[model samples]
Target: MGYRRLDKHILKAIFHRWIESQSISRIHREEGFDRKTIRSYIELFEAKGLRPGLQMPDEDLDCVLQELLPKNTRGRNKRELLAPYREELLRLVNPDASSGDPESPAERPAEVVRPKTAYLILVEKYRLEVSYETFKLYAREIGLTAQSKRAPTRLESPPGQETQIDYGTVGTLVDHHNGKARRVYAFAAKLSCSRLPFIQFTYTQNKESWMESNIAMVEFYGGVTECLLIDNLKSGVLKPDLWDPQINRGYAEFAEHYRTFIDTARVGKATDKAKIERLIPQARELFRRLKAIHPTWSLDELNRQALLWCRQEYGRAVHGTTGIAPMSLFEEQEQSLLKSLPPVRFEVPRYKPVKVHPDRFFTFEHKRYAMPENCRGQSFIARESGGILRVFDASYRLIRSYPVTEQRVCWLPGDFPKSREALMQGAYPRYLLSRARTLGPAAERLIDGI
Candidate 1:
């Protein structure tokens, strides 16, 4: 009877009648099956609670029965076989056991319990005869190994209180004008209150790009939040700290201009800005779908499309958490709470520390700017602010300014004397001729000795 195999039709028929409370003899007669066969299948189903008159569905019962019947019953008895090594394995899993005094549990000092790898213990200590796979299976079955799952927690901020920002790569974007593919990055700013998001794309993530994007985001949102949350990007955050964070001077100055505070998330904690982290994946989906629809567009066109998507599609769509459209929520609840934009816009710039040349000049953007005074080889920070280069001393005081131009050399009126000797050493005759021309045509003819 144990070796007999019944067709699916017969097995199901017997299962239905058995569940209906029919006598075994009657089911055997009605289905034309031997009494013993009916009893066997009926017994199997009833044992697993597939009893008659139960409310469970037939499909679920069938699936459970299949799983129970086909499972191989032959295997090593893991618990019985590994019983001798149980104590040793437990000790390895909890090495702090040795640190505790054996005489009293109360005397045990606090210590970190490190989890030892199963392979090391098996190979070095036990030298178990079984394969690694078998050893691992036994360890799991005996509860020496446990897997943990992490649950993500979300945080919320009051309206107009905080904004979280981050940058993500958008893979390679083809430039329609040049027919060349360039890697692009997307910067996202999400308001913690309404989950309203603003996105902009750029070719690079330098200080200038970051600052410009931030300004654009605030302007687009119509106001700035009280505090701006950002990751440890070198463009904005100089050093990440739990209590006191160090922000880049330029970024700090920019924030000050907007009357907003900068808050940096702890290093390596994405949950600190969970709102932005959650929006990134959804933004990527939008980017992919938009790219497919257009295929090739200039950065300006792509940005236009992004703005439309943010306003028309994402903003108007109901959020999963709040059950209200982001744009509606922002306009109704968060907009009024935000701080108004400042009167004057901040001019963003790239900053770098440079040493004054022996000739009292510093090079930036392939052009030289003569220092206003003799810095005498001292270090200074040069701010390449748009069309102008502003030089600041160690104290960040403005000491020199020059227009960034195509000229190979530029000089301040006060700096010509400091560089005069160096220029003469290189081209004394030419320098004299140039200086003569600057004076007048009469001086030039006189210097020519005509």
Candidate 2:
């Protein structure tokens, strides 16, 4: 039957002989035709929205689902499946006896046992997941995700355990304080395991703000976190990764005082320290409302108002991503994490030594830069960062910094001394300004000023 010529009549005969509900492979076998002919006929029937030869199970559906949920979800789904208290919903509804104590992560306060939840413990067993919807779907299918499950994340710093930092845009509009406004970059911090968020506002997201914000965030978080996590914001981290991230030495030294490990999120990965990611959207929401009111004032005032707005509106609301209010979550998981709030919590960001020359200025592009006088005549290290110019003694102490780009700029500090030698700047001023007043009063005045 399989060798018979395939045609409409033969196909029709085969179709009638096989059951209407039979699979294509089964029908081909029963009808004595190859699967190719049967499948071709099925495709033709499907074009008209009619049943193809047979409706078959989709084996690839599982494959696609697995691919989509590959990162951490498979393990999460399995743990959720094998859990004991899988059906409980642990919402942070109203605080009763079960309501945990309020612990501010910035306090890095004393440790204590807080009121605990079934799913919070259950969630840990599954693995720390940021997306609740994704967690629940897999949990429902396999094991323990409750709709109201709380994830017990220790984002709060351990008496200086960890700091989370990022730069976010603050929306400003016409109605706002400054008639026209530019986006403000916010540097925020929170304890990693505890999750108490602190923020600072700055003019730009450049190296200055990048480091200053970290300084401010540490102060806001109540003390230095022993470890810090950040994105590859060129000003802060030159190279980014889970392992081997290159920290701007200037930023790394700042962390050293707090005895912290500086880690950066891997290229393209956002969930490395996701509690911070969850907090940033709320910052935009606050700015959106305040910017509409057109609150007018200095950058400081605007930031003050913005902070107040966040505390009032967003601080009390339950987090969209986490199942708990940020404040409440901070109080519960982070209080127990505080080690000993150190005495030295504040430090003005400082710079290191990079080298530049005296005769020819270092050019960071079209702009020329200047180093300290002491580095003069000798090969010296000059370090400039965060809107600061610091020339170092060979032993490496602060020297001097010139302000404003005048004939030079130093974008990447690493190339300072070496770049100064480039011959482009060595050329004398082209066509010295004649001043066009050789014998006149204008010439005399120019000479006097010079």
Candidate 3:
């Protein structure tokens, strides 16, 4: 330490690997440096921007201010851009074409903007002095705006950006081989810029299938998108709300791991991503076209056929709006996205350790879930995703999960159901047999009396 002066490079290298146990004072004293000089050195290093602190400098008294402070992203102004319609309240006064059309202005759809604007007019009809323009300005200042044309504060996309995703049940078809009608889920993604829609058909909308569909969507385009825009699908959105959306923890982790942000469209607002929203009808058309040509055996078969359709016809065909084919745009945009996505190891939650009490076998939603006897007194995480629920040990290894698909009421082969059953039986009362005999006598007397 004495051999090197307190220069930027030397100090930085020392700072980077500084041991947590060694204090600045100890460093100064052991190195034969004055405290004042050491303080100045630290100040100079901080002035040159060395991330003086990883977090807050002092947390005890500053908690309130930290909590109250707004993040930079929150300051966006989305309301100012659409105030004219809110002020007019046209939909209130005019339920019909009596109000000017919103789109064409001359032939405004009375069903939507007309009624909305009419309502505004009717509500403020008493104030005839305030001209429509003036009133609209007033409304804008007050943070009220038309619902339809409220533009985002800043133009978000730089073109060829964002993709919106959703899952829907297209229809039910009879499974000929199984003699059963099964509903199929259509998982779809539409790139906002290109409006190029990608879809995959799957049996269920569970987490694994949900993520698998997303992976296929990415690979189909030969790239990973910077952001995945999705609707309030249960697999992705934990709580569906516009102002405060909560993405599923597993899905959020997946997004973080992939270095992508998973953005959710406002709840109940399909029009939030208009480009993708408009493709639903067209997707149905494509699905119909595929169905006419192929006989599907299963949802997996349907998905494969769908992909082939994209490569052969859908991706090649010219886009109605852009006048360019989807595949062509995808090629141009693909380069902008990540070449190699982060590894795809999703968290497989084995079990949420819900205590199976000393007496009651833990059951969830009418099904019994098994927990280890050693887990009786401890609280545990409940791992639930991918249509399966299970419990896990502290180290996160799998302990036991809900019974496998189609194996309900029976343990898997080589699983000792008897041992688990024995442990389960221990929780029951010892006097149950005597109580059962007394109940039997009471039942017979009641029957005779009747």
User: What are the TM-scores, per candidate, against the unseen true structure?
Assistant: 0.62, 0.45, 0.47
Q: List candidate 1 segments past 4 Å from native.
A: 1-151, 403-407, 418-450
Per-residue error (Å), model 1, residue 162: 0.7
In order, candidate lDDTs are: 0.76, 0.53, 0.57
lDDT of 2 by residue, 226-335 (tens): 56778788888877666687788667777676667777877776666677786675565444434333345566766787555445444567865566666676556654
Sorted on lDDT, best first, the list reads: 1, 3, 2
Q: Residue-wise lDDT of candidate 1 within 70-91, one digit each (tens)?
A: 4445588643556676545554
Index of the highest-TM-score prediction: 1
Which of the two, 2 or 3, has more TM-score? 3
Predicted structure 1, TM vs. truth: 0.62
Query: Model 3: per-residue lDDT, tens digit, 159-226?
Result: 44677788776656557668787776678787766556687876688876787677777767655567
Q: Estimate the TM-score for candidate 2.
A: 0.45
Clashing residue pairs in candidate 1, if any? Answer: 19-52
| Backbone clash count, each prediction separately | 1, 41, 28
